[model samples]
Target: MMTDAGEQLEVQLDDCPPGRETFNDPLQEDASGPDSHLSSALRELEEPLLLLADVALAPPCGRAVFYSCPEAERVERSLQSVQLQLHFLLSKADDLHDCLLGGQGHVEREALAAAISSLLYTCQPYFNHLESTARSTMAQYTHVPADMCSTLLDFSQQLCDKLEQLVLTYASYGLLSLNEAEPDSASHFCVGQTQLGQLKLTIFRYCQPTPYLSRANTQLYKRMRWNVERVRDQQQTEEEDGDDEEETFTDYYFLCYEDIPNPHAEANEDSEGVSDGSVVRMWSIGQWVQANPDPSTEDIWDWILCEVPQGGYNRLLFLGHDEPSSRSATDYLQQLLLSCCTD
Candidate 1:
């Protein structure tokens, strides 16, 4: 479980060893001292920023091949921009510290809060882009080591979590205003369209044991509906009579519509005009079977019957939850594929 940022910060502050004081004691120290408690508070604020800078600069945990991708270049430039902003902010922090120490001009708390909030707001999209790029890259590599992919994914998630914690900490101290920050545009775009659904489906497909089909010849189904029902007791009895109390059977129904290309179409030519109409398919899970020949016990889920239309192929999909029923599938899938390329 994750610890609360405020509590974690307090613990770090309290755990300092004897004769190794870092930040001034806000509560015990005299308010009139040369280094006032306010200076300590400023130092406390600077700690998280410095930590974030280090995390941003740390190399990603997988093969460098991901960096060679075009999307990585864009992310690299964004990281550089973030680093520049952090440099400016750190310098501002020093200036604030010096001014407080000398009893000079007062720095407005609200202004400082706004500056931090604005910096966080600007840096958010870059991190978000990095995360999406990493996930998509991982999805594309079938031969890549599983551990490497997992490491990269975890690193991206950790960086985002740290960024969120920093924002929350600043907000708690009234050094940042969460309400005034704008919503993430990428999130808005994903939520407003079916692109997120397509991405999830893509990830799920790639993670399956079967080799992935060519996405170029594939067409996504936009207006799909699913229904789930428990299989009858008689059917279960006939299939298998087991002592396991949790043993149960379920049936899944999918209403699908997909485009299939004409086989006779000329190679290297667009076959948009020769494509067939949509096809619906129903799929079901088969009985459990031993997943391996080893002596150890293991089982895997397998589809029983995958029925395609008479003239077209079927494509199984994992739809996003709470997606609008009226959105165009073709447009959404196209945009999703384009995003993978551009990222």
Candidate 2:
């Protein structure tokens, strides 16, 4: 739970710099049991929790800040503390959910439920951003041991579990009332509007190392669940019987310099018939309609936004090595923004 702070967490960190902060422990000496356990976890967290909070609460600025390598001991300690905290938090949340005095509807009406929902809703982008930046931001930049990989994976699952539990507990309950009309209650959602000629783009870096989401099928497995390797085996199982052929694989453009051989050179030509050595492709509502010959394409777009799963989308693959320290998606992102402004 991020409290409304007097100053931004970023400013506090710059001035106090984590370990240097003079933090007075708020735990009363008389406390025992669960309270004592929580206090101990918090005490161990000290500064690393603040760093996590800062990242969680910060606005999505479309830039990945890979932390400079830290002492291995510090990294392990920080990760361990987070694991401990998450375990306690999940246990307590489950306990509270079970002990609620009234029915689910009654619990949903409580301000506590609404507040928790709001906080989690606000953090929707944070986890998505984390999934995108997990590889380079932590392991590659932190320079930690290979042994930490399992620990890190366990932490990731625990974090995801906490999120799943909370969502199941309060997502629709706190946000939507059974009595209220869909249009009225749905107004609380993070909705966007677009007019004719409108174009909105958000940039994100790919940081998932394991599967790396290289293709539509690989990305599809990730959305199905994180155990992608297993998904490959169980994909055609009777339980998951569905029309696999309907699943679309995005056509991708291999982006590289003029010196590099164009993968699609045989068909290379721009709308204006000018090749500036830049591979090009596009996706839009209009283009989507044109690409798919389905008669219900427009209607499909309207209802499918909520049902649309992550994956099966075309992703840009750069030819060169993506150096964590020297160059990453952030640098290319800067140029994209500059070009947008230039146009």
Candidate 3:
């Protein structure tokens, strides 16, 4: 996954500027003695850092270990990734107790509890997809006793519900439910064969862009953020500059504009069976960088790439194959349209 450019970047990080390390804050020296408390503070931090590092980099074990499952390597990878992601999060939890004993450990309880609860609440889409993929694996090749998948899911959801209540007392940045239709939103689109009656516009359900989409059907995901949707703070701020905060927050940047009508819709693009989204998509990503946030043709990019500079596009999309997967994608582009002509 690490590209040549990425590997080069990694190598460059180890070669810091020649004189960078000699720099230090004069105020810090003044506050402490000649040696400064820096030596002691660094010593204290080293133990905790190593403790966490050990918990993280140690070999996998228990349920966290990857199963030597049957074929369908793609499916296995997906399942393993989810498990590993959770395992890493749990390792951090375990290290907390080891690094900070008793009284200090207990103090973190409220924050951890709230975080876990919030993650579950905000990650319904992830759970739903995970469960479905898990079930596919279970039914196709194996089995779980008593349909425990549903049982576990229900239990987890309920636990999260209880945790959600605890979050009410705190100032929460509740996630935007972008998949759901807004009252005045005019943007809408469909998936898999743009049909007069066939429609599916739900995207942004996943917290971030998903990987390994090739395992399933032909799918697509695109995001477009311009001078888009401006969401306001639900709870009015009590700060003296609350009015400014409210005014500043009122502008919305609609992240993904779904279902750009097929450029040749008259030619029946969806009749071939694929989604048609409108937002401008990346011709290629990870290898390119655009500094400007605004869409403008007149820029330095034109000379560098010898192509007319188009606009800024940082959104990620998983444009799946021409065929359908065992499961399908429901998500992408906007502005004047997605084309190589711009970028």
Candidate 3 lDDT, 1-343, residue by residue in tens: 1133223322332232322243232111011111342223222212321222122222334333232344235433433444443343233334323332342544454444333322332233233333332232223222332233444334333333332233332213231222212431111211111111111111122222222121322133322112212234435553544464443221112233223344543433366665455323422111113333333555666557643322233434434323211122221222112232256
lDDT of 1: 0.32
Task: List the candidate 2 regions with Cα displacement exceeding 4 Å.
Answer: 1-73, 99-112, 119-133, 169-343
For model 2, the run of ten residues with the poorest summed lDDT: 221-230
Per-model CA lDDT versus the true structure: 0.32, 0.32, 0.29
In terms of TM-score, how similar is model 1 to the real structure?
0.25
Which prediction has the highest lDDT against the true structure?
Answer: 2
The digit string of per-residue lDDT tens for model 2 on 98-162 reads: 53435455643454443433332222233233222333233334333334434443444454445
After superposition, the stretches of candidate 3 with alpha carbons farther than 4 Å from their true spots are: 1-71, 92-101, 105-117, 122-125, 132-343
Which model is ahead, 2 or 3, in terms of TM-score?
2
- Each candidate structure's TM-score, on Cα atoms with residue i matched to residue i, is 0.25, 0.32, 0.19
What RMSD does each model have against the real structure?
24.7, 21.4, 22.3
